[model samples]
Target: MYEQISHSLLNDILNRIKPDIYQKDLRHFYTRLGANFYAIHGLFAKLYGNREDFDLQAQRLVETMARQYIKREDELKQLDIERERDYNWFLNQKWVGMALYANGFADDLKDMQSHLSYFQELGVNMVHIMPIMECPEGQSDGGYAVSNFREIDNRVGSLEDLRSLSEEMRSRDMLLAMDVVLNHTSDEHEWAEKARTGDSTYLEYYYTFESRNIPDMFEQSMLEVFPETAPGNFTWDEKIQRWVMTVFNNYQWDLNYNNPAVFIEMLDVILYWANQGADILRLDAVAFLWKKLGSTCQNEHEAHLILQLLKDCCQVTAPGVLFIAEAIVAPSEVTKYFGEDAVIAKECEIAYNATFMALLWDAVATKNANLLNQGIKSLPNKLERATWLNYVRCHDDIGLGFDDKDIIQSGYEPQSHRRFLIDYLTGRFENSFARGLPFAENIKTGDSRISGSLASLVGLQYAIETGDVDAQENSVKLILLLHSMILSFGGIPLLYYGDEIGTLNDDTYLDDPDKMDDNRWVHRPNIDWGKAEKRHTPCTVEYDIFNGLKKMITIRKEINVFSDFNNRELVDVGNPNLFVFNRFNPQKFHDRVLVVTNFNDQPQKLDLEDVASWGTYKQGQLFDLHTRQKPEIFNNTLVIPSFSFYWLREM
Candidate 1:
């Protein structure tokens, strides 16, 4: 790692390190800086070496880490040592996660502190507070267009409230996950504001150009993320008489990582959050970090180098703090976010399993597991140290970004199959009970994503509305079936805020002019405490889902085989209605659990002859872990009912 050119540059930067950096105890700083400087310098050079002020930028980078380290709490420093000792602690099976907006889940960060008991009741030990950073009230982009990296949004309470919440979570043995929007900044952000006011230095912080010539070249290969709503990738700034790259929205200006000053500033923002007691920092839009002409401007090679350098620098300052790469790209590229190393997760310790989420939804709409089995089999294996953030739903629209080969292998034409899924989930297909909406519809490509709450998409909304008891019960089964897969799937299962109690889509967003444009807001609703109270009332719909998920989480934490160790085996049962897999402890093969899911409306039998190698006390002895009861078995075969799943263990 110690290359002469990079080391010599690092040596020059270390020479400029303020005397104050050495005034305190920095033995650990010197050790880590020396260990990581090679990669850091290499990545920094690759990103911004051509700039005239490269030497000055490198000096500021060293100073930034030194200053942050000095301000870091002693208790946190001790935590870093403890985590360094137990490097594999994050890969544990017990770490079940739940993602929620601070305001949606509770009133604010302070109120969220009081709701710790609710999280504990659901057996959640990792909570991701989605984008609490300060942003323009109406142009927030769900808090992604951060106006200030150091401040928590006023709507979500103050920074003190966030710190208190993090402390409370830490005391409860839970991890606090926060977001740092690394790719873009709100135009209202101080730097962007100054750039708008004719500050050339501040303009360098973003991708700004005086003319459309270069923008036209970049737009040739860059895909518009919001083609229908936002239109183009570049937005003309009349004030500055220039064009700025606005990949997400016109108000959200993309930062230029090619500028070392931008890199150093973002690094400081990252360390600032780490000091705020965030155990895990989710890096947003990391795939689009480094942009290049004549390319899609995603998953760039320099992007990976930037992440590697960030990981290395974080290890020096806050070793306990982790990074979750929020890259929802193809299966072939998703694993690279975990890094290319055989053992070490050089880029990120965690990433969203968007593929698994999409594949699960495919199974739900089709009432079959043919695609789920085929898709997962094609999913690339993760690195030894990295883990997945598996979830049934999140605060975004669902894209059916499955590989074409996998679609064909599952006996469906790629384009037609995708169109069928969109139609089915949006209730355009016959007998489809889903009440979802279309998102990001592109007329040119005939492609679009779906947006709806988990309960609504699974027919619970339609069932309850029509007063059909049988359909309602089937909806509940479908909800639990989806949860079972994520729970036992090889990673930390992330539950969305309202999914546990079957919260329906909130159509109120259509009334709010600020939110009416985005359909994803339908699924991101405020928690109704009055309706949530019904979970304690037993016979209600809320009680069924709440209790079912509560029971499943409790059992999941107790199973060690559910850990993310690549110990899962996909079982081809030869029945399209059934999706099967096994989770076993390789060290002790006898400690195993067989997961079987029946997606059809009719009873589906699993032939015992095919899985005889699993060994069993016949079908009668098989018990469902979620329901805690023996299922019906006849002629050495087990029968799973309509829209149901079972985590069977021989008792």
Candidate 2:
């Protein structure tokens, strides 16, 4: 850390620091820079040492950090110091999160400011507001295609509104999470526009070429992200008459991270949001940050370097802020987003547990946890400092990205099982109550993902539509069962916006031309405050879900064992329908809670004899934490009801 070369570079950067930056009141900025200059210099050099203007660019990077730090509020600076003192504070079980779209969750950012009380009522301490950055109207991929990084989208609210909302959220001890589209920019973005005008310097910001000679090679190894819609990875810009690497869509051009200027610009954008009161910045499309020909253009070695560089830079500017890697790749690759380290998360502090979500859906459809268990077994252990953002549902399609070997180990054909899930959720399978739709269906590969709200995909929609009270009750239990797993799964459990109240799929997306093309919009519904009001009535469907989730959240917060200390142990109950796991304090193992779930429609018995060492057992004593009653165990067997879960502790 005290390398002479790095210190020398730091000294050089400090000497070149703008006089205007130092002339202003920048006590906190100078302190942070002094504390982190060594790491910053080292990472910057590693990333751009070969460039002729590396020193000049380094000066600009330092200036960007100083400018953003000066703009940050004094109270926020104090909050940052408090968070730094408690580095692992976010890993606590009490930090429940809810991810929502600003326009959909409320009317806009202003409306969201008023909903702070609602979040507090639900025991949510962190809220991830989906991308609100300025984007082209029709070209925006659900706000992923960012046209401007600094400006707020007018449809949501102004930058002032965001600051106000963030202030409100902070006052209530709730954290705000926002997105920064790191990998790509809208075709209408300034850089893209300049590239179109044949600006050679701007063209270097993206992967643009006059010939398809290199793009064709990359296509051979790269799989289509949107095979049915976007087709290939490259898109032709008629105005520029050049091929641009557009992995997601033609309107979204992938940023060239190999260029040092692009890297510095994105880092500035990241720090800008942190200064704007974003506690966590979810870096979008991180896996595709670096692209190399003859490879899949994802999970590349240089991609990790880019993230490492970015993380190091942020450590100097805003160490209190955390990064969420939005790389929904394979389980092995997903873990790497936390970075290759022994005890530290060099790349991101948090990463989405997309594999766990997909695996949970598999268990629901099959009425068993065989595949879930097998798939989880294959999941690599993450870095000690990093935690997962586990959730049952989010504003995205559920892609069955399970490992093929895990499917074989679970005694199922990989292709057929995936097909069965798609059919079951889409209502193509017999006796299936789910009314979901297929998304990104590739006819050649017969691969597709499912898209539907938590309630609709879980059969509550069909149950309510048919007026089947029993079916509805069972669906509600199923929803609670899934929530229980994420709650006790040794990580931060993230609830989607409307999942707590059983919001059904909105077919109205079919009426919107811009949204109808994307089936994922079916699940991304606007919150109905009127329907949400029914949560207070005990007998209402809204009441059942809302109160059930609220109770679960309260219970989860009370259990310290549920924190991310890697203290979970999977129990082999021998029954396929019974998924059992235990969470205990590593220091005091007896301070534990046993989580047992039944995926069956009938009563499933767990043999108490097999779990004697796993819990407190003297041949007969039983406890169910959720219901606050002794579970009936006859002849050393405990009965679990249909679609139910028990958070059992010692009686």
Candidate 3:
């Protein structure tokens, strides 16, 4: 296990270790650092080897990892060892996640602790609390624009509250996920403030130029991220009298990864949060980390290299900690975040399955699975150690980022089909009941994204306003149908905060001027304790949605084939109204479940003969696991009810 070059460098690094730092028990620390140091050194050299200060920076890199390893608590160290022994634990099906804002889900972190029972009641074991980092008031991009990396925003709670919450969560067998904004920081950050005063060293931390000559070269290939809102990729910094790269907002400045010092500093911040008891660190805006002229500056190869280096350094310090990539790009590009290795994930252990989420919405609008099945076939295979985080809707606008080739393959024109989706979701199309709104519409390109809650986008809002009992029941069934896919889709299903109770599009953000321009806030609602209590009341909208999800979650926990190990096979059923797939235990193919979901409002029949070889027959019969009863079979044809699904098992 010894590399001559890496071992020689490690010996030199240990010789320069500070005398004042205490290293009481570092047996596991030295062991892991030795195992991972070879890759860590090679990646660092690839990134910064050309610089004159390469040797000095290499010493600092090893020193930083050692310091963080020393700061790690004993309990966390033990967890790291236990996790290393069982490397694929996060891919287990027993884990269910929910993402929410710190204050939106509860008043603050202290109050969040009291609501732990609510999550347990719904069988959710993984919790992702959105950004509570210090950010500029009124300019925070929902806490993405961090003014300080080490301090928690006082409005949410202090660092002590986060540590306490992590402790309580571990006691209850739940995982804690926190955000660490990697691509940029607020202009008010300490380094930004120092750079404004003409400090050369601090100015290297950000991308600042003396003229528009360079930015102009960058603009030719880089499209605007927020075209209708921010309009450009560079901002004029009057304080420094220079142009600075601001990919997302003017107040947020992109960090210069070309500078080796900035890379080392961000690596320190990542380990800082890992030491704070964050089990999973969600790296935001990871796709835009590396920028190059005459290119889109997204999904760049350098970005993947940076992620690989960051993950290797994390392994040296906290092996148990995992990373979730927040890269919402094309399907082919998104899978790159998991690294190029065939057997293991060298970059991130998990990534958002945005393609599946967008495809599911397309099926809901067309009332068929033609595009859904076709689009899913184009989904790239992930690494063996990596899994997808599947969800229905989240706290962001839905961008129709499908590839044009896939649209053509599915028998639809690319441009017109996207326009039709916008028209349908926004209720501009004839008889369309969806109440979603168009967000960030670009007049030049005639393109826009849809923004609305899960309930409003799927006819629950319209059904309630019209007081149609039949539509209400259909909406409830459709809601369960969507949840059933993510649950049985061979990945970890992440439920949003308000989705369980059918919370509608909240227009309350319109009253707050700071949030009025952003339509995405409509879905990020404050938890209504009073209304949430109706889950216990039968025949209520809240009761129907809540109990439906609870029952599905319980059943998913009991299914052994649902764990993500690349054990899913998409069925090409002739019926376009039904989306069918097969899930089986990798070790035992005979133990399998055939999933059939109907997206149409009309009843559809799936013949058993279509899946005769799919699984072993048990007395020539199939059982519905969700209903705990045998499926209705009349002459070898299973008649699925309108907007229904079945987790059928045989043998």
Regions of candidate 2 where Cα sits further than 4 Å from its true position:
24-35, 615-620
lDDT of 1 by residue, 28-80 (tens): 88888889888788877887788888888888888899899999988788889
lDDT of 3: 0.90
Model 1: which residue pairs collide? none
Query: Pairing residues by index, what is the TM-score of model 1?
Result: 0.97
Q: For residues 176-242, could you state the per-residue lDDT of candidate 3 as single tens digits?
A: 9999999999999999999999999989999999999999999999988889889899999999999
Error of 1 at 103 (Å): 1.2
Q: For residues 98-119, could you state the per-residue lDDT of candidate 2 as single tens digits? A: 9999999999999999889898
